[model samples]
Target: MRQLGGTELKRLHRSWRRKDSFRLALLLEDVQSPFNVGSIMRTAAALSVSELFVSGRTAAPGSPKAQKTALGTGRYLTWSTHEDVATAVRAARADGYHVVGLELADEAEPLAAMDLRRDVCLLIGNEDRGLSASALGLCDAVGYVPQTGRVGSLNVAVATGVACYEVRRQAWADAPAVDSGDAE
Candidate 1:
């Protein structure tokens, strides 16, 4: 099998487009690491998330370390800073998006089981504390990635990637099939 070269890969990416406009927003609360912010930006851009909102003490997208890790992807993403998590959550809800928190809480449902077909504002918290109590209270629902490994939790960036993928997966599954015209 042959691998696609840079030009071909770029062309492939240009040709790919989402069939449905699934509004997926990411809310980062008090995530201090610039590297993590950048990494999450990359993941969000790659998955075509509609917007990113960084709140509280989360690192800004303009941070040097974050920009370095983002490798220019941050420039292409729609992101903004909010005064606090509550305001961000309120804005998302006001805009008709379902605010869901990505945290391992007793009330959280498995990520795979949640119906992600609606517009979602996924709330991810700080590296150490996860979502704050107030943040959790604001979420319409909470979801957690089920893990069986020795480690009880995943890094925030990794968890964001997984959750984004799940959202996209469900969107694709719900989308009507289109014929590409390939035939024998």
Candidate 2:
């Protein structure tokens, strides 16, 4: 495959930068590790996430550890700090987003098979505890990244990337097909 030039890549990245667009929001709850927070922020930025809402005792994006891991991506991504996850969920839902929690629950659907529709808000929880009952209750649906390895699950940041990519992939796939109307 051909590689994109620097200008082409910049244009592609800039295509999704809509300040007022409510495409998707990322909800981070009670995440303790700064490195994980930073890594998620980097992924969020690259994916053109509309906003990031961090709640509970999650590490702030301005911290040194976050800066080190995020490598300046946080500077481009818009984020807000919330005191609680419910408030974040409420605000996002009120804005017409379908809140989906990324967790491995008994009833959770696998990411690969999920058909995400409309605008979505991705909820990522603490590493050790996952989503609290109250927080999970607010989700429209729960999703999991299927794994075959002995390790039960993936790190939060890694899992977040997989989930985010799936959402993007599905949305792109469902988009109106383009017809060049020319011979291949």
Q: How many backbone collisions does model 1 have?
A: 0
Segments of candidate 1 deviating more than 4 angstroms: 10-16, 177-184
- Model 1 TM-score (2 dp): 0.91
How big is the positional error of residue 48 in model 1, measured in Å on the Cα after superposition?
A: 0.9
Model 2 misplacement above 4 A: 1-3, 11-22, 176-184
Give a tens-digit lDDT track for model 1, residues 30-89: 999999999999998888878898899999988999999999998778887889999988
What is the per-residue lDDT of model 2 for residues 18-42, given as tens digits with 9 covering 90 to 100? Answer: 2223377799999899999999999
User: Each candidate: what lDDT?
Assistant: 0.87, 0.84
What TM-score, over all chains together, does every model reach? 0.91, 0.87
Give the clashing residue pairs of candidate 2, or none: none
Judge candidate 2 against the unseen true structure and give its global Cα lDDT, from 0 to 1.
0.84
